[model samples]
Target: MPFELEVCIDNIESLSTAIAAGATRIELCSSLALGGLTPSFGFMQQAAKQSTVPIYAMIRPRQGDFLFSPQEFDLMLADINAAQEAGLSGIVIGALTASGEIDTKNCRNLIKAALGMGVTFHRAFDLCKEPTTALEEIINLGCERILTSGLAPTAEAGSEVLKQLNELAKGRISLMAGAGVNQSNVKGIIQQSGITEVHLSGKGFRNSLMTFNSSNAKMGADEVDDSQIPVTQHQAVANVKAVLDSLS
Candidate 1:
C-alpha cells in the first residue's frame, strides 16, 4: 500500500484543506497552539459535516500532561463517547501515571468507551517510561496505531528507534511518524523507519483579515501574538502526498 497522509486539523476550514488535498485521515483537535486539545462539540460536528476523510478526534480535555484527575478523566471518557457518537473515524487518546507508565485501567476504560471504534495512542507514548513495553501494552489494549516521535525532539531524529519499534511491532500495530514530518524528509523517515503512515499540520501563515487592528487587544496571554494566523494550505498537503506517492 502507498504511505497514508494524515493531517492534523484544528478547525472546519482546515478540514476543508485536508479534503481538498486528499488526506487519508484527519486528527482533529482544537487548540493547536497548546499542542491540540479536544475540540468543541459544534466544531467537531461541523467537521463531520464538512470533512470527506475519516477523523480521529483528539480526546484530551486540557493543555497539559496526559495524567488526569478523576473529574478530568471522567470528562475525557465523556469526550470519547461523544466523539464516537459524533461520527469521527476513531478516537485519539492517552493517559499516563506520574511514573511515566501507561494508565492501563483508565486507558482500558477509554477503549471500552469507543465500543469497537478505531483508536490511536497519541504522542503521550513518547513520554512513557519504555517504548517497547508500552507498544505491547497498547497492542494488548487493541489500539489500531500510535503516533510518536520515538521519544526524540523530532521524528527524523527518532527514525532509528522508530525502525526498532516497527520490528518490535511486527504488524501487530502501526507506528505513525509525526512531529516534524514534511515533504522534504517524509520519504526518508518512511524509508528508514519502515512506517507507512505519517501525521502533520499543513499549516501556513496568513495575516488576519482585519481592517483596523487593536494594538492592545490580544487573544492569547503573550507578549506579541502577531495576527499572522496559521491556516492549513491544501497545496502544501498535496505536495507532501505527492512525495509519499512517488516513493511508494
Candidate 2:
C-alpha cells in the first residue's frame, strides 16, 4: 500500500498550495511559527469549500504547553464544536496533566465532543513521561491516530521510539511519524519506524515585499518598515510526488 502524506497548513493559501501539491490530507492550523493555533470558523468553512482532500483542524487554543486550564479546556471544546459544524473532516488535539501524564478524563470528554468526527492525538504524546502508558490511555480514549516524533525532537532522533510505538499499537491506532520529516529522511523514517502515515509541512521560507506610503511618512522616513520579511513557501505538487516516489 502507498504511504499516506498529511500536510500541515497554516492558512487558505497554504491549503490551496497543499492540494495543488498533491497532499492526500491536510491538518488546518494558524500561527505555524508558534506551533499552531485553531483556525477561525470562517477559515475552516472556506478551506472545506476549497479543498477536495480531508482537512483536520488543529484544536490547540494557545502555544505555550500541552497542559491546559479549566477555562482553556472549555475553549478547546468550543473550538472543536465550531470546527465540526464548519464541516471539518477531523480534529488534532491532546491534553496532559500537571504531572505530564495523559489527561484521560479531559481527553475522553474531547473525544465524546467530537463524535462522528475523526480524532488525532497530537504531539502531546511526546510530552508524556511514559509513552507506553500514554499510548494505552490514548487507545482506550479511541483516538483514530496519534502524531508523534517518537518522543524525540525529530523523527530521526525518535525513530527507535517510533518503531516501538508502532509495534505496541498493533493496528489499535495509527502511528503517524512527524516532526522534521522530509523527502531526504522520509524513507528512512518509514523503514525504521514502520509507520504508514507521515506528516510534513513541505514548506520553505520566502521574503515578502514591503509596501510604504510616502504620504504617511514622518521625518522623511517610510511609515512601513521594510527591512525584514519572511513568509512560508507552500510546496508544489512535485514535492509531494518526490516523497511518494521515495516511498515506492
Candidate 1 lDDT, tens digit per residue, 157-233? 99999999999999999999999988798888988999999999988877888898888777777854667777788
Task: Please give, for residues 142-171, the per-residue lDDT of candidate 2 as tens digits.
Answer: 898999999999988899999999999999
Q: What is candidate 2's CA lDDT for residue 208?
A: 45
lDDT of 1 at 223: 57
- Score every model by TM-score: 0.96, 0.89
Point out the worst 10-residue segment of candidate 2 by lDDT: 224-233
> Against the unseen true structure, what C-alpha lDDT does each candidate score?
0.89, 0.84
Q: Candidate 2: where is the Cα deviation over 4 Å?
A: 209-237
